[model samples]
Target chain A: MTPQAQRDILKKHGLKVTAQRLAILDYLITHETHPTAEMIHQDLPMISLATIYNTLERLVAAEIIIVIDSLSDGKRHFDYYGQPHYHIVNTQTNAIIDAENFDVAPLLAAARQASGLNITGFHIEVYGVNPEDAR
Target chain B: MTPQAQRDILKKHGLKVTAQRLAILDYLITHETHPTAEMIHQDLPMISLATIYNTLERLVAAEIIIVIDSLSDGKRHFDYYGQPHYHIVNTQTNAIIDAENFDVAPLLAAARQASGLNITGFHIEVYGVNPEDAR
Candidate 1:
Protein backbone atom coordinates (compact mmCIF):
# COMPACT_ATOMS: atom_id res chain seq x y z
CA MET A 1 0.00 0.00 0.00
CA THR A 2 1.02 3.61 -0.48
CA PRO A 3 2.25 5.72 2.44
CA GLN A 4 -1.14 7.44 2.58
CA ALA A 5 -2.97 4.12 2.65
CA GLN A 6 -0.79 2.78 5.48
CA ARG A 7 -1.22 6.02 7.38
CA ASP A 8 -4.96 5.72 7.03
CA ILE A 9 -4.83 2.18 8.44
CA LEU A 10 -2.73 3.29 11.39
CA LYS A 11 -5.06 6.14 12.06
CA LYS A 12 -8.00 3.77 11.99
CA HIS A 13 -6.29 1.64 14.63
CA GLY A 14 -5.35 4.67 16.72
CA LEU A 15 -1.66 4.07 16.01
CA LYS A 16 0.60 6.77 14.64
CA VAL A 17 1.97 6.13 11.19
CA THR A 18 5.66 6.59 12.02
CA ALA A 19 8.62 6.16 9.72
CA GLN A 20 9.43 2.81 11.31
CA ARG A 21 5.91 1.55 10.73
CA LEU A 22 5.95 2.64 7.10
CA ALA A 23 9.34 1.08 6.44
CA ILE A 24 8.35 -2.19 8.07
CA LEU A 25 5.07 -2.43 6.22
CA ASP A 26 6.71 -1.45 2.96
CA TYR A 27 9.41 -4.05 3.39
CA LEU A 28 6.84 -6.71 4.23
CA ILE A 29 4.84 -5.97 1.11
CA THR A 30 7.94 -6.01 -1.04
CA HIS A 31 9.09 -9.28 0.42
CA GLU A 32 6.32 -11.74 -0.28
CA THR A 33 7.70 -14.22 2.22
CA HIS A 34 6.60 -13.62 5.79
CA PRO A 35 9.49 -12.72 8.06
CA THR A 36 9.91 -12.79 11.78
CA ALA A 37 10.38 -9.62 13.77
CA GLU A 38 14.09 -10.42 14.01
CA MET A 39 14.40 -10.68 10.24
CA ILE A 40 12.64 -7.33 9.90
CA HIS A 41 15.15 -5.85 12.38
CA GLN A 42 18.00 -7.31 10.36
CA ASP A 43 16.97 -5.17 7.42
CA LEU A 44 16.51 -1.96 9.41
CA PRO A 45 19.73 -1.22 11.24
CA MET A 46 18.38 1.98 12.72
CA ILE A 47 15.11 0.67 14.10
CA SER A 48 15.24 -0.45 17.70
CA LEU A 49 14.17 -4.05 18.40
CA ALA A 50 11.55 -2.73 20.78
CA THR A 51 10.00 -0.72 17.99
CA ILE A 52 9.71 -3.79 15.79
CA TYR A 53 8.01 -5.62 18.64
CA ASN A 54 5.56 -2.80 19.14
CA THR A 55 4.85 -2.49 15.43
CA LEU A 56 4.10 -6.19 15.06
CA GLU A 57 1.74 -6.14 18.03
CA ARG A 58 0.03 -3.03 16.78
CA LEU A 59 -0.39 -4.37 13.26
CA VAL A 60 -1.87 -7.61 14.54
CA ALA A 61 -4.34 -5.77 16.77
CA ALA A 62 -5.39 -3.56 13.90
CA GLU A 63 -6.39 -6.68 11.92
CA ILE A 64 -4.64 -5.16 8.96
CA ILE A 65 -2.42 -8.28 8.66
CA ILE A 66 -2.26 -11.88 9.71
CA VAL A 67 0.68 -13.76 11.20
CA ILE A 68 1.19 -17.50 10.69
CA ASP A 69 3.73 -19.52 12.63
CA SER A 70 6.44 -20.67 10.27
CA LEU A 71 8.19 -23.98 10.91
CA SER A 72 10.95 -22.91 8.52
CA ASP A 73 13.73 -22.97 11.10
CA GLY A 74 11.82 -24.05 14.15
CA LYS A 75 12.00 -20.39 15.18
CA ARG A 76 9.20 -17.86 15.41
CA HIS A 77 8.97 -17.19 11.68
CA PHE A 78 5.81 -15.47 10.47
CA ASP A 79 4.16 -15.05 7.09
CA TYR A 80 2.13 -12.23 5.60
CA TYR A 81 -0.14 -14.07 3.19
CA GLY A 82 -2.62 -11.16 3.52
CA GLN A 83 -5.16 -13.73 2.38
CA PRO A 84 -5.95 -17.30 3.27
CA HIS A 85 -3.79 -19.90 1.58
CA TYR A 86 -1.83 -23.04 2.28
CA HIS A 87 1.96 -22.76 2.63
CA ILE A 88 4.93 -24.89 1.70
CA VAL A 89 8.15 -24.71 3.71
CA ASN A 90 11.42 -26.26 2.64
CA THR A 91 12.64 -27.30 6.05
CA GLN A 92 16.19 -27.63 4.78
CA THR A 93 16.38 -24.36 2.85
CA ASN A 94 14.03 -22.34 5.05
CA ALA A 95 12.30 -21.07 1.95
CA ILE A 96 8.55 -20.38 1.80
CA ILE A 97 6.12 -20.77 -1.05
CA ASP A 98 2.80 -19.02 -1.11
CA ALA A 99 0.47 -21.91 -1.91
CA GLU A 100 -2.65 -19.87 -2.38
CA ASN A 101 -3.76 -22.13 -5.18
CA PHE A 102 -3.59 -25.51 -3.48
CA ASP A 103 -7.06 -26.69 -2.56
CA VAL A 104 -7.74 -27.89 0.99
CA ALA A 105 -11.38 -26.87 1.26
CA PRO A 106 -12.61 -30.29 0.29
CA LEU A 107 -10.43 -31.93 2.92
CA LEU A 108 -11.64 -29.59 5.66
CA ALA A 109 -15.27 -29.90 4.67
CA ALA A 110 -15.02 -33.68 4.69
CA ALA A 111 -13.38 -33.69 8.11
CA ARG A 112 -15.97 -31.36 9.52
CA GLN A 113 -18.81 -33.48 8.27
CA ALA A 114 -17.27 -36.80 9.30
CA SER A 115 -16.56 -35.87 12.90
CA GLY A 116 -19.72 -33.86 13.35
CA LEU A 117 -17.25 -31.26 14.58
CA ASN A 118 -17.04 -27.56 13.91
CA ILE A 119 -13.58 -26.45 12.94
CA THR A 120 -12.77 -22.82 13.59
CA GLY A 121 -9.80 -22.85 11.24
CA PHE A 122 -6.83 -24.89 10.24
CA HIS A 123 -3.11 -24.06 10.40
CA ILE A 124 -1.06 -26.03 7.91
CA GLU A 125 2.72 -25.83 7.60
CA VAL A 126 4.09 -28.31 5.06
CA TYR A 127 7.75 -28.97 5.84
CA GLY A 128 9.53 -31.11 3.33
CA VAL A 129 12.73 -31.31 1.30
CA ASN A 130 13.05 -28.95 -1.65
CA PRO A 131 11.97 -30.18 -5.06
CA GLU A 132 15.62 -30.40 -6.08
CA ASP A 133 16.69 -31.95 -2.78
CA ALA A 134 14.10 -34.68 -3.20
CA ARG A 135 15.87 -35.68 -6.39
CA MET B 1 0.32 -42.06 25.83
CA THR B 2 1.93 -44.92 27.72
CA PRO B 3 5.68 -45.44 27.53
CA GLN B 4 5.25 -48.43 25.25
CA ALA B 5 2.89 -46.57 22.99
CA GLN B 6 5.30 -43.69 22.70
CA ARG B 7 8.16 -46.05 22.12
CA ASP B 8 6.26 -47.78 19.34
CA ILE B 9 5.39 -44.47 17.71
CA LEU B 10 9.00 -43.29 17.98
CA LYS B 11 10.40 -46.55 16.73
CA LYS B 12 8.14 -46.32 13.72
CA HIS B 13 9.70 -42.94 13.03
CA GLY B 14 13.25 -44.15 13.85
CA LEU B 15 13.21 -42.34 17.20
CA LYS B 16 14.04 -43.76 20.61
CA VAL B 17 11.13 -42.36 22.62
CA THR B 18 13.32 -42.07 25.71
CA ALA B 19 12.30 -41.30 29.25
CA GLN B 20 12.25 -37.62 28.43
CA ARG B 21 9.97 -38.12 25.44
CA LEU B 22 7.59 -40.18 27.47
CA ALA B 23 7.52 -37.61 30.24
CA ILE B 24 7.05 -34.73 27.87
CA LEU B 25 4.19 -36.41 25.98
CA ASP B 26 2.65 -37.51 29.25
CA TYR B 27 2.78 -34.01 30.63
CA LEU B 28 1.39 -32.65 27.39
CA ILE B 29 -1.60 -34.99 27.31
CA THR B 30 -2.31 -34.50 31.00
CA HIS B 31 -2.22 -30.76 30.60
CA GLU B 32 -4.79 -29.88 27.95
CA THR B 33 -3.43 -26.37 27.42
CA HIS B 34 -1.23 -26.17 24.35
CA PRO B 35 2.19 -25.21 25.69
CA THR B 36 5.51 -24.14 24.32
CA ALA B 37 8.64 -26.29 24.49
CA GLU B 38 9.87 -24.10 27.31
CA MET B 39 6.78 -24.92 29.35
CA ILE B 40 7.29 -28.63 28.73
CA HIS B 41 10.93 -28.32 29.76
CA GLN B 42 9.88 -26.57 32.94
CA ASP B 43 8.23 -29.74 34.18
CA LEU B 44 10.92 -32.15 33.05
CA PRO B 45 14.04 -31.08 34.92
CA MET B 46 15.76 -34.31 34.02
CA ILE B 47 15.36 -33.98 30.26
CA SER B 48 17.76 -32.03 28.10
CA LEU B 49 16.53 -29.31 25.78
CA ALA B 50 17.88 -31.21 22.81
CA THR B 51 15.63 -34.10 23.70
CA ILE B 52 12.58 -31.88 23.62
CA TYR B 53 13.60 -30.45 20.25
CA ASN B 54 14.26 -33.86 18.77
CA THR B 55 11.00 -35.27 20.11
CA LEU B 56 8.91 -32.52 18.57
CA GLU B 57 10.46 -32.90 15.14
CA ARG B 58 10.20 -36.65 15.15
CA LEU B 59 6.62 -36.66 16.31
CA VAL B 60 5.64 -34.15 13.66
CA ALA B 61 7.27 -36.16 10.89
CA ALA B 62 5.69 -39.39 12.11
CA GLU B 63 2.27 -37.71 11.78
CA ILE B 64 1.57 -38.71 15.35
CA ILE B 65 1.09 -35.06 16.42
CA ILE B 66 0.66 -31.53 15.09
CA VAL B 67 2.10 -28.18 16.17
CA ILE B 68 0.46 -24.80 15.89
CA ASP B 69 2.31 -21.56 16.59
CA SER B 70 1.04 -20.01 19.79
CA LEU B 71 0.91 -16.19 19.74
CA SER B 72 0.41 -15.98 23.48
CA ASP B 73 3.57 -14.01 24.28
CA GLY B 74 4.86 -13.47 20.75
CA LYS B 75 7.20 -16.36 21.33
CA ARG B 76 7.72 -19.63 19.41
CA HIS B 77 5.11 -21.49 21.42
CA PHE B 78 3.89 -24.90 20.22
CA ASP B 79 0.46 -26.33 20.74
CA TYR B 80 -0.04 -30.10 20.67
CA TYR B 81 -3.56 -30.22 19.39
CA GLY B 82 -3.05 -33.80 18.25
CA GLN B 83 -6.30 -33.47 16.38
CA PRO B 84 -7.61 -30.38 14.57
CA HIS B 85 -9.45 -27.72 16.56
CA TYR B 86 -9.74 -23.99 16.86
CA HIS B 87 -7.64 -22.32 19.58
CA ILE B 88 -8.37 -19.40 21.88
CA VAL B 89 -5.43 -17.66 23.51
CA ASN B 90 -5.65 -15.24 26.40
CA THR B 91 -2.72 -12.99 25.60
CA GLN B 92 -2.41 -11.45 29.04
CA THR B 93 -2.44 -14.63 31.14
CA ASN B 94 -0.94 -16.90 28.47
CA ALA B 95 -3.81 -19.29 29.14
CA ILE B 96 -5.10 -21.35 26.20
CA ILE B 97 -8.69 -22.43 25.66
CA ASP B 98 -9.61 -25.20 23.29
CA ALA B 99 -12.34 -23.72 21.12
CA GLU B 100 -13.01 -26.64 18.84
CA ASN B 101 -16.70 -25.87 18.62
CA PHE B 102 -16.64 -22.45 16.99
CA ASP B 103 -17.79 -22.84 13.40
CA VAL B 104 -15.76 -21.07 10.73
CA ALA B 105 -16.51 -23.43 7.88
CA PRO B 106 -19.28 -21.29 6.46
CA LEU B 107 -17.06 -18.23 6.55
CA LEU B 108 -14.17 -20.09 4.96
CA ALA B 109 -16.36 -21.66 2.31
CA ALA B 110 -17.86 -18.30 1.45
CA ALA B 111 -14.38 -16.81 1.29
CA ARG B 112 -13.34 -19.59 -1.07
CA GLN B 113 -16.22 -18.80 -3.37
CA ALA B 114 -16.08 -15.00 -3.18
CA SER B 115 -12.77 -14.66 -4.99
CA GLY B 116 -12.56 -18.03 -6.70
CA LEU B 117 -9.84 -18.63 -4.14
CA ASN B 118 -9.17 -22.07 -2.76
CA ILE B 119 -8.89 -21.63 0.98
CA THR B 120 -6.29 -24.06 2.23
CA GLY B 121 -6.66 -23.84 5.99
CA PHE B 122 -6.96 -21.22 8.68
CA HIS B 123 -5.20 -20.44 11.96
CA ILE B 124 -7.41 -18.54 14.31
CA GLU B 125 -5.81 -17.29 17.53
CA VAL B 126 -8.21 -15.28 19.60
CA TYR B 127 -5.80 -13.30 21.75
CA GLY B 128 -7.58 -11.38 24.43
CA VAL B 129 -7.51 -10.66 28.15
CA ASN B 130 -8.92 -13.19 30.58
CA PRO B 131 -12.32 -12.76 32.22
CA GLU B 132 -10.87 -11.63 35.52
CA ASP B 133 -8.28 -9.45 33.83
CA ALA B 134 -10.98 -7.80 31.76
CA ARG B 135 -13.05 -7.15 34.86
Candidate 2:
Protein backbone atom coordinates (compact mmCIF):
# COMPACT_ATOMS: atom_id res chain seq x y z
CA MET A 1 0.00 0.00 0.00
CA THR A 2 1.16 3.55 -0.67
CA PRO A 3 2.21 5.76 2.22
CA GLN A 4 -0.83 7.93 1.51
CA ALA A 5 -3.09 4.88 1.66
CA GLN A 6 -1.52 3.87 4.98
CA ARG A 7 -2.06 7.35 6.33
CA ASP A 8 -5.67 7.24 5.16
CA ILE A 9 -6.24 3.96 7.01
CA LEU A 10 -4.74 5.37 10.16
CA LYS A 11 -6.93 8.39 9.84
CA LYS A 12 -10.01 6.29 9.10
CA HIS A 13 -9.35 4.42 12.34
CA GLY A 14 -9.06 7.80 14.16
CA LEU A 15 -5.32 7.26 14.63
CA LYS A 16 -2.96 10.14 13.98
CA VAL A 17 -0.64 9.25 11.09
CA THR A 18 3.00 9.18 12.13
CA ALA A 19 6.11 7.94 10.38
CA GLN A 20 6.37 5.01 12.84
CA ARG A 21 2.75 3.96 12.28
CA LEU A 22 3.06 4.22 8.52
CA ALA A 23 6.30 2.23 8.48
CA ILE A 24 4.79 -0.58 10.54
CA LEU A 25 1.54 -0.68 8.58
CA ASP A 26 3.48 -0.60 5.30
CA TYR A 27 5.66 -3.47 6.51
CA LEU A 28 2.66 -5.61 7.48
CA ILE A 29 0.96 -4.83 4.17
CA THR A 30 4.07 -5.70 2.18
CA HIS A 31 5.06 -8.76 4.16
CA GLU A 32 2.67 -11.66 4.73
CA THR A 33 5.07 -13.31 7.16
CA HIS A 34 2.98 -12.58 10.32
CA PRO A 35 5.81 -10.97 12.26
CA THR A 36 6.40 -10.34 15.94
CA ALA A 37 7.17 -6.83 17.18
CA GLU A 38 10.85 -7.72 17.41
CA MET A 39 10.84 -9.00 13.83
CA ILE A 40 9.23 -5.78 12.62
CA HIS A 41 11.84 -3.78 14.47
CA GLN A 42 14.65 -5.82 12.91
CA ASP A 43 13.49 -4.80 9.44
CA LEU A 44 12.83 -1.15 10.40
CA PRO A 45 15.78 -0.52 12.67
CA MET A 46 15.11 3.19 12.46
CA ILE A 47 12.00 2.76 14.65
CA SER A 48 12.65 1.92 18.28
CA LEU A 49 11.21 -1.32 19.66
CA ALA A 50 9.08 0.60 22.16
CA THR A 51 7.70 2.75 19.37
CA ILE A 52 6.90 -0.26 17.24
CA TYR A 53 5.09 -1.90 20.15
CA ASN A 54 3.12 1.25 20.99
CA THR A 55 2.17 1.84 17.36
CA LEU A 56 1.15 -1.77 16.89
CA GLU A 57 -0.97 -1.63 20.04
CA ARG A 58 -2.79 1.42 18.73
CA LEU A 59 -3.38 -0.17 15.33
CA VAL A 60 -4.68 -3.32 16.97
CA ALA A 61 -7.02 -1.36 19.24
CA ALA A 62 -8.28 0.52 16.19
CA GLU A 63 -9.07 -2.81 14.49
CA ILE A 64 -6.53 -2.14 11.75
CA ILE A 65 -4.62 -5.34 12.59
CA ILE A 66 -5.01 -8.60 14.51
CA VAL A 67 -2.72 -10.51 16.80
CA ILE A 68 -2.14 -14.27 16.69
CA ASP A 69 -0.59 -15.91 19.74
CA SER A 70 -1.59 -19.52 19.15
CA LEU A 71 1.63 -20.58 17.45
CA SER A 72 3.92 -23.07 19.16
CA ASP A 73 6.67 -20.46 19.61
CA GLY A 74 4.62 -18.54 22.23
CA LYS A 75 5.29 -15.23 20.44
CA ARG A 76 2.59 -12.79 19.34
CA HIS A 77 2.34 -12.42 15.53
CA PHE A 78 0.52 -9.49 13.98
CA ASP A 79 -1.39 -9.63 10.70
CA TYR A 80 -3.18 -6.92 8.83
CA TYR A 81 -6.93 -7.42 9.29
CA GLY A 82 -7.84 -6.43 5.77
CA GLN A 83 -10.31 -9.33 5.68
CA PRO A 84 -11.47 -12.20 7.81
CA HIS A 85 -9.54 -15.49 7.43
CA TYR A 86 -8.00 -18.34 9.36
CA HIS A 87 -4.35 -19.31 9.63
CA ILE A 88 -2.23 -22.43 9.15
CA VAL A 89 0.77 -22.49 11.48
CA ASN A 90 3.86 -24.61 10.98
CA THR A 91 4.53 -26.25 14.33
CA GLN A 92 8.25 -26.61 13.78
CA THR A 93 9.27 -23.38 12.11
CA ASN A 94 6.62 -21.05 13.55
CA ALA A 95 5.80 -19.96 10.00
CA ILE A 96 2.25 -18.66 9.45
CA ILE A 97 0.40 -19.39 6.21
CA ASP A 98 -2.90 -17.68 5.64
CA ALA A 99 -5.63 -20.18 4.72
CA GLU A 100 -8.74 -18.42 3.53
CA ASN A 101 -10.32 -21.48 1.95
CA PHE A 102 -11.93 -22.87 5.11
CA ASP A 103 -15.07 -21.08 6.16
CA VAL A 104 -15.66 -20.78 9.95
CA ALA A 105 -19.22 -19.45 9.89
CA PRO A 106 -20.76 -22.87 10.45
CA LEU A 107 -18.45 -23.62 13.36
CA LEU A 108 -19.11 -20.24 14.93
CA ALA A 109 -22.82 -20.83 14.72
CA ALA A 110 -22.42 -24.22 16.30
CA ALA A 111 -20.44 -22.73 19.18
CA ARG A 112 -23.12 -20.11 19.76
CA GLN A 113 -25.83 -22.77 19.87
CA ALA A 114 -23.81 -24.99 22.16
CA SER A 115 -22.79 -22.25 24.58
CA GLY A 116 -25.89 -20.04 24.28
CA LEU A 117 -23.73 -16.93 24.19
CA ASN A 118 -23.78 -13.89 21.92
CA ILE A 119 -20.94 -14.71 19.59
CA THR A 120 -18.45 -11.96 18.83
CA GLY A 121 -15.33 -13.27 17.06
CA PHE A 122 -13.42 -16.49 16.52
CA HIS A 123 -9.81 -17.64 16.09
CA ILE A 124 -8.91 -20.85 14.31
CA GLU A 125 -5.34 -22.03 13.83
CA VAL A 126 -4.49 -25.32 12.19
CA TYR A 127 -1.05 -26.56 13.19
CA GLY A 128 0.94 -28.59 10.69
CA VAL A 129 4.39 -29.50 9.43
CA ASN A 130 5.55 -29.50 5.83
CA PRO A 131 5.78 -33.03 4.43
CA GLU A 132 9.30 -32.37 3.19
CA ASP A 133 10.31 -31.19 6.63
CA ALA A 134 8.67 -34.19 8.29
CA ARG A 135 10.57 -36.50 6.00
CA MET B 1 -7.93 -37.02 41.14
CA THR B 2 -6.26 -38.32 44.24
CA PRO B 3 -2.71 -37.31 45.03
CA GLN B 4 -1.46 -40.79 44.18
CA ALA B 5 -3.37 -40.76 40.90
CA GLN B 6 -1.86 -37.41 39.93
CA ARG B 7 1.56 -38.76 40.86
CA ASP B 8 0.96 -41.83 38.71
CA ILE B 9 0.04 -39.69 35.71
CA LEU B 10 3.14 -37.59 36.20
CA LYS B 11 5.31 -40.70 36.38
CA LYS B 12 3.66 -42.10 33.29
CA HIS B 13 4.54 -38.91 31.45
CA GLY B 14 8.19 -39.35 32.59
CA LEU B 15 7.94 -36.31 34.87
CA LYS B 16 9.20 -36.31 38.41
CA VAL B 17 6.40 -36.46 40.97
CA THR B 18 7.28 -33.35 42.90
CA ALA B 19 4.90 -31.68 45.32
CA GLN B 20 4.78 -28.52 43.22
CA ARG B 21 3.99 -30.46 40.03
CA LEU B 22 1.28 -32.46 41.72
CA ALA B 23 -0.30 -29.34 43.18
CA ILE B 24 -0.49 -27.61 39.83
CA LEU B 25 -1.85 -30.69 38.07
CA ASP B 26 -4.44 -31.29 40.74
CA TYR B 27 -5.52 -27.66 40.58
CA LEU B 28 -6.01 -27.84 36.83
CA ILE B 29 -7.82 -31.16 36.96
CA THR B 30 -10.19 -29.87 39.62
CA HIS B 31 -10.82 -26.50 38.02
CA GLU B 32 -11.90 -26.25 34.41
CA THR B 33 -11.62 -22.45 34.44
CA HIS B 34 -8.43 -22.52 32.30
CA PRO B 35 -6.47 -20.26 34.58
CA THR B 36 -3.34 -18.21 34.00
CA ALA B 37 -0.20 -18.60 36.08
CA GLU B 38 -1.23 -15.67 38.26
CA MET B 39 -4.68 -17.12 38.78
CA ILE B 40 -3.20 -20.46 39.69
CA HIS B 41 -0.77 -18.78 42.02
CA GLN B 42 -3.66 -16.98 43.66
CA ASP B 43 -5.30 -20.30 44.48
CA LEU B 44 -2.12 -22.08 45.53
CA PRO B 45 -0.42 -19.38 47.56
CA MET B 46 2.31 -21.69 48.80
CA ILE B 47 3.61 -22.25 45.30
CA SER B 48 5.62 -19.36 43.97
CA LEU B 49 4.80 -17.80 40.59
CA ALA B 50 8.13 -18.99 39.19
CA THR B 51 7.46 -22.59 40.21
CA ILE B 52 3.92 -22.51 38.87
CA TYR B 53 5.22 -21.30 35.52
CA ASN B 54 7.99 -23.88 35.44
CA THR B 55 5.72 -26.77 36.38
CA LEU B 56 3.07 -25.69 33.91
CA GLU B 57 5.69 -25.44 31.15
CA ARG B 58 7.02 -28.91 31.95
CA LEU B 59 3.52 -30.41 32.01
CA VAL B 60 2.70 -28.76 28.69
CA ALA B 61 5.94 -30.07 27.16
CA ALA B 62 5.02 -33.57 28.33
CA GLU B 63 1.56 -33.31 26.73
CA ILE B 64 0.04 -33.67 30.15
CA ILE B 65 -1.48 -30.19 29.79
CA ILE B 66 -2.04 -27.58 27.10
CA VAL B 67 -1.47 -23.82 26.98
CA ILE B 68 -4.17 -21.63 25.46
CA ASP B 69 -3.35 -18.08 24.40
CA SER B 70 -6.24 -17.40 22.02
CA LEU B 71 -8.49 -15.58 24.49
CA SER B 72 -9.00 -11.85 24.15
CA ASP B 73 -7.41 -11.28 27.56
CA GLY B 74 -3.95 -12.08 26.14
CA LYS B 75 -2.99 -14.25 29.12
CA ARG B 76 -1.84 -17.85 28.75
CA HIS B 77 -4.38 -20.26 30.27
CA PHE B 78 -3.57 -23.86 31.13
CA ASP B 79 -5.93 -26.75 30.50
CA TYR B 80 -5.62 -30.47 31.10
CA TYR B 81 -5.16 -32.30 27.79
CA GLY B 82 -7.30 -35.20 28.91
CA GLN B 83 -9.22 -35.04 25.66
CA PRO B 84 -9.29 -32.86 22.58
CA HIS B 85 -11.90 -30.14 22.83
CA TYR B 86 -12.41 -26.50 21.86
CA HIS B 87 -13.07 -23.47 24.08
CA ILE B 88 -15.74 -20.78 24.29
CA VAL B 89 -14.22 -17.54 25.56
CA ASN B 90 -16.31 -14.84 27.22
CA THR B 91 -14.80 -11.71 25.76
CA GLN B 92 -16.17 -9.58 28.55
CA THR B 93 -15.22 -11.83 31.45
CA ASN B 94 -12.29 -13.85 30.10
CA ALA B 95 -13.95 -17.05 31.36
CA ILE B 96 -13.30 -20.18 29.30
CA ILE B 97 -16.08 -22.65 28.76
CA ASP B 98 -15.29 -26.06 27.31
CA ALA B 99 -17.30 -26.85 24.17
CA GLU B 100 -16.90 -30.48 23.21
CA ASN B 101 -19.87 -30.76 20.87
CA PHE B 102 -18.13 -29.28 17.82
CA ASP B 103 -16.11 -31.73 15.73
CA VAL B 104 -13.07 -30.11 14.09
CA ALA B 105 -11.74 -33.17 12.29
CA PRO B 106 -13.32 -32.12 9.02
CA LEU B 107 -11.94 -28.59 9.30
CA LEU B 108 -8.46 -29.88 10.12
CA ALA B 109 -8.58 -32.20 7.11
CA ALA B 110 -9.56 -29.32 4.85
CA ALA B 111 -6.70 -27.20 6.21
CA ARG B 112 -4.28 -30.08 5.54
CA GLN B 113 -5.45 -30.29 1.91
CA ALA B 114 -5.34 -26.53 1.42
CA SER B 115 -1.85 -26.09 2.90
CA GLY B 116 -0.41 -29.48 1.88
CA LEU B 117 1.31 -29.73 5.25
CA ASN B 118 1.42 -32.67 7.66
CA ILE B 119 -1.19 -31.58 10.17
CA THR B 120 -0.02 -31.82 13.75
CA GLY B 121 -2.66 -30.23 16.02
CA PHE B 122 -5.20 -27.43 16.05
CA HIS B 123 -6.48 -24.67 18.34
CA ILE B 124 -9.98 -23.19 18.00
CA GLU B 125 -11.47 -20.48 20.21
CA VAL B 126 -14.94 -19.05 19.75
CA TYR B 127 -15.30 -15.66 21.44
CA GLY B 128 -18.65 -14.68 22.82
CA VAL B 129 -20.49 -12.93 25.64
CA ASN B 130 -22.90 -14.56 28.04
CA PRO B 131 -26.47 -13.64 27.19
CA GLU B 132 -27.32 -12.65 30.73
CA ASP B 133 -24.34 -10.32 30.83
CA ALA B 134 -25.13 -9.01 27.37
CA ARG B 135 -28.61 -8.06 28.44
Which pairs clash inside model 2?
Answer: none
Per-residue alpha-carbon lDDT of model 1 for A8-71, expressed as tens digits? Answer: 7678778877899888877776787688888989999799989987888778666555666655
* Candidate 2 iRMSD in angstroms: 1.1
The structural similarity of chain B in model 2 to the true chain B, as TM-score, is 0.86
lDDT score for candidate 2 against the true structure: 0.86
- Model 2: per-residue Cα lDDT over A1-135, one tens digit each: 567888899999888878888889999998998999999999999999999999989988787888898776668889998888888888778878887787788888889988889987778888888899753
Candidate 1 falls in which docking quality class? incorrect
- Candidate 1: give the clashing pairs: A122-B122
Following a full C-alpha superposition, what root-mean-square deviation does model 2 have from the true structure? Answer: 2.7
Superposed on the true interface residues, model 1 gives a C-alpha RMSD in angstroms of 9.4
Q: Which run of 10 residues does model 1 chain A get worst, by summed lDDT?
A: A126-135
Question: lDDT tens digits, residues B1-135, model 2?
Answer: 678888999999899888898889999999988889999999999999999999998998887888888666768989998888888888777878887887788888888988889987778888888778754
Q: Provide C-alpha RMSD values for all models, in order.
A: 6.4, 2.7
Whose lDDT is greatest here? 2
Q: Candidates' TM-scores?
A: 0.64, 0.87
Provide per-model DockQ scores: 0.14, 0.79
Candidate 2 DockQ vs. native: 0.79
